[model samples]
Target chain A: MYDYSSRPSRLPLPVDERMASADIDLGQRKSIYRSLQELRQFEKRAHDLFLQNLVKGTTHLSLGMEAVAAGFGAAMRPDDYTFATYRGHAHALARGMEMGPAMAELLGRSNGVLGGKGGSMHLTDVSRGMMGSYAIIGAHLCIANGAAWSAQMRGSGQVTVCFFGDGTTNIGAFHEALNMAKVWQLPVVFVCENNLYMEYTPIDLITAVPHPAADRAASYGLESVIVDGNDPDAVYLAAGKAIGRAREGGGPALIEATTYRTGGHSRADPAKYRPLEEVEAWAQRDPIPMYHARLLGLGVAEGELSSIERDVAADVDAATEFAKAGEEPTGEALLTEVYADGSSRWRN
Target chain B: MAELTYREAVAAGIAQEMRRDPSLVMLGEDVAAAGGVFKTTVGLLDEFGPDRVRDTPISEQAILGAAMGASMTGVPVIAEIMFSDFLAVCWDMIANEIAKSRYMTDGQVSFPLVIRTANGGAARFGAQHSQSVENWAMMIPGLKVVAPSTPADTVALMAAAVRDPDPVIFFEHKSLFATKGEVPEVEVVGRLGEASIVREGSDATVAALALMVPRALEAADRLQQEEGISVEVIDVRSLVPLDTKTLLASVEKTSRLFTVEENPRLCGWGAELISIVGEEAFWNLDGPLVRITTPHIPLPAAASLEDLAIPSVDRIYETVKSSLR
Candidate 1:
């Protein structure tokens, strides 16, 4: 049985050590490093847009946690299903969603992927296989399990990637979904973004165990692995193996990616709960700069790295212009798609 | 036409849909080898094989979540929660994910799924096991709610629920499972929002649903015998897209309305029906609208206490008599 009571002293996240000796090829390393840098820039731009009152409602920007999103998104097939949390802009971007429509969605424009209705919390594009972003904390686990089950039923060899936070593991649905996934051997990879804090509460404050993925795997009798989420190579390697195992019918796996949240839980939170020293320490291990250093060490020229940054900046600028010029849905379109078969009583 | 029990009708409805649509799959606790605790899925495994008829763990969230994902992907799914009360465990999926997916996705996806669960009281099962929450589903805009009192209606409505392009909550009353009624030998599919005037009279309109339909008919018989009062019993089978036209026509002829429901008195389906009648046909009403429902308390496990807690033939009769008076 896993011990629940003894609290261990704080330890440095594994990515800190893993980044020093990341054994990735030049081509793969450059690609992974550039992807992390682009995601970071995208989120930072989103933050700036929020500050400028351009992005409406709330955008849960994944400021410091770009490597896990890049790594997991890179490892999965284009047809693989991705069920994401509300802080899913990076996940969507990593899964090949164009920055223009994604930014347009945050702006609640008619040209958005969800036609402006979903805003930030519910971004979906089934054709691209990003099933959607569910705002409810732990609710998508079973639904993603169902997606895996459906693929099994249809003989469609599709794998589902369900992303959630560490706080989600405390929910009853998390236990229920994990147990079912284990029993049924569903083809799903549960990716827990263990950024330490679930909103304001730290993992140790709410959970008995220190590692949520390993603890939950032991409870559900499912296979589990942990990785340094700040290292794109670590996330890519672990998720690649997990997704391959699931696709080959080895059943579901849990991956606990230990990273840190640099931004507030949401748009309005100032993140006063995080200690200044801890934030400063995590800032030293920022995934973007760490990967940038690794790419330079791997013989990628400084000029090429700067070109990647400049290109991403231009891309973010173009995305903003697209969203600002996009249309908003009229009142007539309010009742248009309430029912797939148009059976809503809103229709005359 | 052939006679069948409510259990057989429900099973046949599911089996027929499975046969017609290869993509239709059923999953729930004990629905496979056990054929369901209520035998609602009896002989389904043998006919459809284990792939189509699956036995799930006792996880309501997984059941609903999997059903939502499966339906959105391709196949039409039927997720049978063993009891209607278990819906509370998976209410978020039904209300948030399943019901809202199609609309929230802007019609990019369809949730072709049915949540079939057994409800109602009188078997001494306590409050947790026995509940009539069809009204809770009725309040959701994207969902369709169906309750069948008789086996024939069960066959047609079950088929309709499976065929519906949206999520449907099919509430089957526990007490009515063994009740026999005549159904067609061939397949029957009833449109969801249509109501049936099971019995016709002229004095007052008694709108009842699910298990209350038979009791309402019995009360109508007693009222005709005792006080020469004629009552039209309207089975409001579809609660969400309610057959308000048929109900209002019945109310127009009768000039009085008495709604009977087995759920709690406050905010019940009866209140919605009465409100619709009051709003649309208040000038035709000859008496105040009356609602017959259970008291607002959890049901006890004793037969006497359960009987006292819920609506019954006697309660329906008294409420109707007073409404007519």
Candidate 2:
């Protein structure tokens, strides 16, 4: 039902929102938009690199998912741990893993995250506390729960955020982890980016229940919120509330951010299998342009947006060049990382 | 030297370690109140209090998972997974998380964690709980796997496991719990990469672990008396960082070798022993080193069948005598 071309026309741009705030005059909103553009552009490069590196692989680009990462990413401090799913490109980019190395990782270059070994799904940057992205669906929730419990035990005031899709809710591990989190009052933020599709299947056809994320939260007696994920500002505001409540020992919070995967499930599909009308409708509510229009509405020149775009493009270009040029890791690397000390037992 | 049962020696090892280092803690089902299913932790709660000696929920995953967490945060924790067979529930936490944490973290983290579990089918605990899982430890990376055959070896190796900056699976044979022996009063940490030579001979090398160590020694004693075949018994206390030097050195002296283990033969811990013998001491081997193990079947509950299931003294001696021929 939403108009596709004029999605940004629906609301004030993020730049405009900065102007509209009652008394605050900080350029945080503009900073968020600028930082987000960096995330999307780099991720786009990484996606292409991933496609090139992997033989017959699937890669999910977070083109419409940037705002979610930026919002929650900027809101939290560094020591907090984050567990993300396969659709975690933006989250990694947002968490400050240098663009070049991460891009190299996608390209399977020696310069990548695991010296270009883990590829996209296994990208890990421990300095950022982005515990390695999990390949198994819903299993990461238990790891995140354990990480949060560790934080609670350490008195580090460290918060844990677990990012998964609507499909993860159907898993038994997800339910068990959520129940444990609520019962133990672990300071965890369960971020459900309900992008309306699990992979190819629509949320409705796949799940038995409605409001698949938030409805399940109440069963465990944990507080939850439903937010407009398309709007980064809304996500940031909601995350701020939820993260604050969790850090204060208010148990755990389940945040359902309603959005859509504008791109098809993976690199392969043209998404021709999807009903065209439904796809068109979701595109109309696309997050990028609406925020752009909002920015222009607040007396921001078109040149400012272009400048941000230019910077992002340049960043992505440099990352791609860097990844492409990185030296190939030696065959010895395969022998390495099997253990901390790299025991020579397997070696001849 | 203070006299104690084999169970009491284990308790003393835990108590001494806890007293020696403030960071050590123990968690198992009923470890605090009932003092372990084997009563190995008896009077520990009274001495150490509730926090240090914990009675965890009947969740094996959580028990091992918490120990991994505590270890990561700079404590050396020893957790008991009630029965070695129950370890199947938390195998992921052990193999993937605890065992792999150090290596996966690129040496950023050190998991100085020890897991103590009792294994073997000597008591007829049935197929579900009686299987020897030394092979499971062999499968996991970043873990030092050891099974102590004697009370002295158990005390020493456990102490070494706690002190080592790696995840160590300390397996104690259930049948060996009440079996008393001369354990040293002041424990000396045994070298991990060295195989202890229990008995010396010339004809063959007998390698074993846990209760099988004594059984192999017993088999060697019998082989000498019956056939005048002197077998050198080598206790392979740890399997992961296998003492290839000492083992091969003994194998070099005695061209023939036999392995006796309580576990099943298929992809079993005995396979690794065979492989090692095939590789390192290949030219030295007069013939194939035979592996004496339980037949590949679920251990039966009947006592007579259970005795047949495990490698007996005569069985090991027969295997060794046959290998010599």
Instruction: Say which candidate scores most in lDDT.
Output: 1
After superposition on all CA atoms, what RMSD does each candidate show versus the true structure?
Answer: 3.1, 4.8
> What is the lDDT for A236 in model 1?
86
True contacts kept of each: 0.67, 0.10
Per-candidate interface C-alpha RMSD?
Answer: 1.8, 3.8
Superposition TM-score, candidate 1 onto the true structure: 0.95
Candidate 2 lDDT, A99-136, residue by residue in tens: 88877767667777777556677666778977756665
Worst 10 residues of 1 chain B by lDDT: B99-108
- Residue range B1-325, candidate 2, lDDT tens digits: 5556678778877887888887577877889999888888898899988768877666666566557655664556888987899888777777776665544434545678889998877888989889899998888767878887777777778788888777888887888889887777785566565678999988888888888888888888888998999989998888877877877788899987788888898988778877877987799978887888999999999999989999999898778777676
- TM-scores of all predicted structures: 0.95, 0.87
Candidate 1 CAPRI category: medium
Worst 10 residues of 2 chain B by lDDT: B100-109
Error of 1 at A151 (Å): 0.8
Evaluate model 2: give its TM-score.
0.87
